[model samples]
Target: MKENIDLFTNLLEKKYGVWNRNKALFGTTPYGKVASDLSISSSQFSKLLYGTATEGMYERTLNNINRLIERQSIEKAYEETQLVINKSKTAYRKRIYFFSILFLGIGLITSYLFDFNHFAFKLSDYEKHPLKSYFYPESSMFFDSPFIYNNAISENCPCSGFEGKWKLSESFKLPLPGMKKPGLYYQAKSADMIIRCSNLFDSYIDKGHGMMGYEHLKSEIWIDTKQEPLVPQYFNPSSKVFTESFKQLNFESDPRFKKIADLAAFNVNMFKIHGDSITRNAELTGRLAIDVNKKLAKKYNIDIGYIVKNVLGDLIKASCKTTFNPFCNPNDLSEGISKISFDCVYTINEENLGLNEGYPYTKSYLFKDQVFSDYLPCECEDN
Candidate 1:
């Protein structure tokens, strides 16, 4: 019994990278650390490492080690089999050369009359449609558009401007928690556009799709402003000199607008928009308003009520109109811009906002208001 226990201890030491001489001398301290690191219980580790017990525990530990050793042995056997097959093939080739020579005289007569090339003939037809032309009939010819190719871009690739230079526009700011200042800003101009988050552009470029749906649009915009503007220039036309708001700024509350506002508010929070004592509190309050408006819109599905109750009623009531400054007053002014810089304001005009130049500034039917022809693809059926 003692000998059997000793044999097991020796095997454990050898298999676990410990010398047989040191197995008995090294106590549970070293074993315990290894066990803890491996996330195994100390009792199981001690029994396996020390061989201090007998019965069921001993058998279990021995079986575990035996299974590991058996796996190694099986792998070694597979390697040996592959080696034997390689050697056998080499020997067979040597024998085949001698056998071929012995049958060479008879093979020459048989090969002369039988031509393999004639049996496998093909004709080149350049006039055929390029897609239909095939070198081999059995080969696959199915191909997909290069633009929507899935493997063309990697999904895990980081965003392009994530680490690049970005400047915040002055007029935009969202309130965020624990921020010393407003968030950073960035814009994606048509020529300057880079694929970063998703492959929407590739699909749009290939298929002539005007733009991806709202979901795609959602992922593309990333705002990191210190105080996300209550009314961003992109969304607000009243602040810009040249740009016009969607002709119907009725403020009649659409549920969709609340969702948009909520999304904007969440972005403000995540990016930490508020800068200091003056700017910080109002933006945060505004973000809360935005969030409340969103929840109310979602719950009631009546955005007009939400806008009236939350923004027009709740927010305006809490804010002091007397202290408001379009420039210095953080809460009163738009989040992204202080009143100082003119360029801080983003406008809808093609000249001011270089990003949306391709999009029409005015409605297609209202082109008489401006001389510029609609460059955006017309939805009209007739040319």
Candidate 2:
């Protein structure tokens, strides 16, 4: 039991990252710090510091110390093990749920398009055969040969190095059309996609090789394109309170940080506005579909000229309007505005519009018709 207590005490010191010392002889500095922090007395600390062999003292103090250490170790181990188990279980459940939903969605789509007899025949044939059924009518297109739909799928090509797919390759040659020069271009894909590397000895170091290696390749196209600022409004910097707040944030926070918090809040508001606009447009489009009258147009503010003028972009002209009917059809609404860029109209001035001193102007754009219709009640009016 004496040997066991000594071994246990040694183990406790080693496990807890603490020092092993004689309780009575040790200076008050270390023992006093521990006792003060732990709310234990000198004698109590001494028992843990140098365990005893007597049954009563050993059971009461020494055993309790061992039990406490053991409990901590066990609890830590249990938490770590439980975390791993929970993560694995969650992943397994997600995979099962995903595949089940995918299969179910495919089944529903198949059932909707094909008759029962054809569907059952195809299913049975598919179950029995692999390669032959792979090229079947309905299943062949998206499920069997997804590459047909997604043409970008190719052999382990050079582009993968830049895009982060291939890691072993030292460098990649971009196949830019009509480029006089071709070589590895080191840049980040976007501002949001910068790579960071820390000391290899650090626990937080992520050393996985691949796109992670080429994460430094950032995209600065927005800088050159000179795209209209998303939020061009100037925020009013006139208020003493606001100026102080701005100073506090700018000085204390990270230097690289942009004033994105306000931009994010503005974006959220824009999204809400856009969502409301879409709902109103859908209602207007439905009304137009049934009756294309002047009253309906007036009520919904459906200016045919505006729609025609808005859809004049090169991409929009090439895609939706060219192939689809009614040049500006209602059914083609989904595909038409999928990629339209709406210029944001509002501005935030940190200072009074007249005083441009401390106030910085932010430029923003919203997709036209994406925000609440021009007819909706203005929230600013309420204010």
Best by lDDT: 1
Every model's TM-score: 0.19, 0.19
lDDT of 2 by residue, 1-383 (tens): 65646654554453354553644222333666545544447676666555533444443343234334444655789999988867787779899889999999998998889887575444323222122233233543456431112233122111111121111111111111111121111111111111111122121111211111111111110010111221222123344112332323221143432110000000000011111121000000000011123443343333423322221111111111111112111122221132222221111122222222322212111112211111211121110
Writing each residue's lDDT as its tens digit, candidate 1 over 1-383 gives 56547655655454455543454332333665545543347886666545556664554444444434434555789999988777787779788788998789667766686674432221111122122222113445573322222342222111111111112221122121112232212212111111112232331122221111110001111223223332353234343332234233222252223222322221110011111211111111121122223343344333433333332222211211111112221122221232211112222222322322122121000001111112222121111
Superposition TM-score, candidate 2 onto the true structure: 0.19
lDDT of each: 0.29, 0.27
lDDT for model 2 comes to 0.27
Candidate 1: where is the Cα deviation over 4 Å? 1-4, 13-43, 51-54, 88-383
Which lDDT value does model 1 have at 351?
32
